[model samples]
Target: MKHKTPLLDQLESGPWPSFVSDIKREAEARAKNEKGVDFQIPVEVCEDILGVMELTYEQKRTHWKHGGIVGVFGYGGGVIGRYCDQPDLFPGVAHFHTMRVNQPGGKYYNTDFLRKLCDLWDKRGSGLTNMHGSTGDIILLGTYTHQLEEVFYELTHDFNQDLGGSGSNLRTPADCLGMSRCEYACFDTMALCYDLTNEYQDFLHRPAFPYKFKFKFDGCPNCCVASIARSDMSFIGTWRDDIKIDQEAVKAYVAGEIPPNAGAFKGRDWGAFDINAEVIDLCPTKCMAWDGKKLSIYTPECVRCMHCINVMPKA
Candidate 1:
């Protein structure tokens, strides 16, 4: 028996606000004057309704089921279990997405690996994704009734990458590009960040913690990543000792070869204005001395403030 399209039937059935009304109209028009309707009849429906129905049915079908598994990947990797909802679907299988570990500083996968992941995503589950979720993990949406382990095996076929960050765990850390390029850097922040990530991978993936943790590093005092503001753990490099002062360099600065205020030394109001008398007197090392005609640095007492160099630039 042929069934008239449900579209128009549904629309004319009620004035209730819905997309079902529109589709019912279309379906009725398409299957005009049809007799009996089969349960298999494919009536057009909105994507949202279809998705909702699919999810609802899936949940119902799998409810009370146990042992389903899911995985998340990004800054770190790990599997999660949903032992509570529909234990039937995951019988002996854990529920929840596994996390994929990430290299420190947000490294991207190589072309081949990326291609493989895309292919796997297309075949195994819902195409929906969270590129970098709050925990900094790549989130894959919707896994099947089974096949979690297979998916895990396929994804980790290459060298075992880490699944680093997740719930209650230390989050993926970030840092500035350190001594490699910047002149201001006192340490290799990038390397340090990576090392820390490796050293603390367990702390990253586990859910055992009093509170979520975050870490960040800066090569210098600039604090490029705002480590102090956002991170539970933060590091910034600075010299415990005074800045280095070259007496000859200071003289050269005095002779105009170097600008007195070109770098950090260029700031004003050093508590002294006169190069020979006031500024020199303030030097902790008594580095700066005046002969009433020419200016000289004791060299041994030079505290590296570059104050005398700034004032007596012509000495």
Candidate 2:
């Protein structure tokens, strides 16, 4: 049966990308497949998912009913229990649960690995996934209670992977792609992340802590991973010594020969670069000064905030 979702359909008309559109597309595909071809999830499940969501929109409240503590055997965390309140109307989504699969270090994966993972989820899950959730895990969106163990086994045995932490356990540790791509990296963020995850597998796989914990690693002060703001334990790399200055590059920036902020603002017409206003003035510690041609930095007062180095990479 075609599910009428007028309220949810309104979300598809705007300029922004809508998840409603994606779900509708999946629902349509599943509906057309008469022979139940492929490992695609049932069309009723997709339709019921839309039905439940539309009900919530119409009622201005959630229709999800939290189930009791539930997870796969031998693992206390990773699986989250969710049940729809209107089970009779949406039985296909009645036991909808979520599984958090631990992503590879730095999220590196080959095509074979990804295809196998998708195939596994398609066979056992609702076929919805978050590429990488906030905690840096692959979120497998909807499955039944009975299929949890089989899904976990296939993940571990077939895919050679495990689940990420949830509940009171240590959440998945995430790190920026450090030495692999970033030149500013002072340490091996991915290596450290891998090592720590293995060292604390017990804590990561079970609810051993009173409160939820997290670890995030950033190779340099740039903190592309937002380690400082989000993680309970943050590892931010920084150089303790003085920053080496390149006089020729500094002159190049001053002469408008080089773009500021490593050419990040190249598209915008920000006019000429100003050393005193852009670099020195923006320095949090106020330890830098530019004397016409030369840039001076007091070593002791420097907090190594990286603003100067980021602005003048050559210097």
Off by over 4 Å in 2: 33-41
Q: lDDT at 264 for candidate 2?
A: 93
Candidate 1 Cα RMSD (Å): 15.0
Candidate 1's C-alpha runs over 4 A off are 1-100, 104-109, 141-147, 179-184, 221-224, 238-315
Against the true structure, what is every candidate's RMSD?
A: 15.0, 2.0
Q: Ten residues in a row with the worst lDDT in model 1?
A: 39-48
Model 1, span 204-297: residue lDDT tens: 7665587778888877666777677868888887656654445665456444565544445556554423344446667767755555455555
* Model 1 per-residue lDDT at 31: 45
Report the C-alpha displacement of residue 181, candidate 2, in angstroms: 0.9
Q: What is the lDDT of residue 44 in candidate 2?
A: 72
lDDT of 1 at 146: 53
Number of backbone clashes in candidate 2:
0
